[model samples]
Target: MSTPTLLTGRDPRSESALLLLSAASGAADAFVFICVGQVFAGVMTGNLVLLGASAAGVGEHGVALRVINALVSYSFGVMCCAWMSERLRWPLPVMLLIEVALLATGAVLWALDLITSDGDRLGLLVLIAVAMGIQGRIRATPTNYFTGTLTSLVSRVTLRSRDQGDSWVAGRLIAVVAGAAVTALSVRFWPGAAAMAAVVPAAGALLVESVPRRTSRG
Candidate 1:
């Protein structure tokens, strides 16, 4: 399908799907920081800085190791998404389905009390980081408005809104915060399902992406 230009029309379906994915990142990052460790699953800058802090000898006991692991694992996910999506030529939803599956597995592990030790923590971090990495790349690598740099995205949003009168860009930042808040509540009130539940938005995104696009009549 051609890219929907919001100057004259909009693709709420596609935008909504992307928004849900944004919320998933928020939820996943919050879950990792609060439950698993101090490192962020989606935000690489945080982990990188934390790693630097560790190098300066001013961080948690295992901070260096964990952040490095998360960084490497997250990259692996990004690589896999880029490679497989090209080789397999599957729909975007199918690729995100893989991410959701990985997220669900972590949820299951946590809910079942399977992640109870250092080794388990390592595994959980890897799982979530990989999933987040895929989330980070899926949009950037596609023919979409999503970009790696926030400055670029904001610039594009401003330029389009002014010239083309395109709809404002997705409220991805808000979605992330909302997801984090919900995940925090889930972790506090419903520990068993917290991990699994945190992934609801991602699953929702997958469903949204699976829907057939609407066609306009002449």
Candidate 2:
């Protein structure tokens, strides 16, 4: 089988969609880490470090369990998305739909004040992680983890290129940072409502994907 053309294709609409998804990822990460626990919903690499720290007895109560649940659930989501993409030809809109459903469910639970127990919180995190995993696979971009992308883009900016896509990269980085900051503030003041705010970007991504692409005539 051929490798997936995950991020090669470039268009204004696709880039906009990816930027919105990146914002959602940043917001979800901040919300989960602050409101739920000190665990990331999308950044698996950070979770691994946190899991190691928790195993070594370094953090608060239930940190280990939360990290483990996120790891396992994220892996499951990746596998599920891979299977669906391969079998169903990997429709971007369909993948976005799945992500929207999961995120919407988490938002509803948060709004309804249902995440009262440790288990409920864990379930919510897992749901968000799964949604994020599916989204990560769908885009296969560095938007969720912008640190590395930013580093690379900064390096590239020094050497001006014929196609200056670095502007888009910079825009995405700003969006992620802005989204995280906004969501962190929301979670601090309005805990339940923050989840709804996180859902907005995911919905935007879905809407962007649903629009039909225009082809050029030779």
Candidate 3:
């Protein structure tokens, strides 16, 4: 194996924070997909809650099942990303293609009313989940939102730091917030297509820049 560069030397905490940030951003956008587009895009928590209700024989068991499908689909997307990352020297384009296809399909489904009932919604959720999964493994640290997991961001932000530290970490946190905000706006107003489009440029940047630039040390 080739020796990895310093850029790949990601600390555990930083990696975790980035991953969580990605997940949160993705989840925020997914909320729009699930609530407005009749799809479960990310953040399985919603689906899990619905599932618990279903297990209790609640009114809408379909919602729970739909969530489950989304979870599975997201898992598959992650796997695909991992596999592609290993197989192809350049994986970003492959990932972009996958997301674009899924978004397009979702649009068609939404337009056709094929995404009406719980079953239909479940199918769309799965598709979105897969897309998010691919997004999760984009770089050494996740550049795209995963949606399935984001609780880490809250924990990381609340954790006590010994000192003010360099602005690097602070800047990353800000980026996380900004990215999520943009994603939320896109998802809410433009739906999946716009949300994916918003991420595309960032994804391209991440692809071109192998490492995140940091402050020069004295």
Candidate 4:
């Protein structure tokens, strides 16, 4: 059997899937930052900066712990997903289901107001970080983080005036911004609802994957 091309596919469905994943990333980030303190769920680079600031005595109290927990959890998630992908044939769907389970758990915890203590909050953070880490690995296009996407977008746009790269990057950025805005607003008014809302896009991506593609007859 040949190796699967999970990422690096350029089909329309893949593009749509990437957009949904990007939106999911945005919502997850906003939800965690707002409810679980100022820690990012998906953007590890920002977490690293926060870690650095804390080390230099410039960050808020407990920020270092949050950053550390997120980093460790995300690393664990990535390692686990990588191993699973290597061993499992249906790695993409399996990873997506795992992410859904994690997010659903977080949503339940948030809804029950169980994330009152540092430990409780850390648990929530771990779930979100793990889900996002798996997402970062699964998507063919960049989804969970924007820095790399933005850099690549700039390079592509600079080299070519009108191209697929421009459209793809622009669409993804828009999706991320839109998702963050919607979820942030929801979180501001209804925290529990926002937690649940983060799961929708991931679910949508799964639905997209479930649809069978039509093949041409010779």
Using TM-score as the measure, the top candidate is 4
Model 2 TM-score, 2 decimals:
0.92
Q: Cα-based RMSD of the predictions, in order?
A: 4.5, 2.1, 6.3, 1.6
lDDT (10s digit) by residue, model 1, range 68-149: 9999998999898877666655567777889999999999999999998988999999999898877766774221123443
* lDDT per model vs. reference: 0.75, 0.83, 0.52, 0.83
Tell me the spans in candidate 4 whose CA falls farther than 4 Å from its real position. none
- Score candidate 4 by TM-score against the native: 0.93
- 132-201: candidate 3 lDDT, tens digit per residue: 6665566454444323213444445568433333244444555556655666666568654434432443
Winner by TM-score between candidate 4 and candidate 2: 4
Clashing residue pairs in candidate 4 are none
Clashing pairs in 2: none
Question: What is the Cα-based lDDT of residue 217 in candidate 4?
Answer: 100
Candidate 4, poorest ten consecutive residues by summed lDDT: 1-10
Model 2, stretches more than 4 Å misplaced?
1-9, 159-163
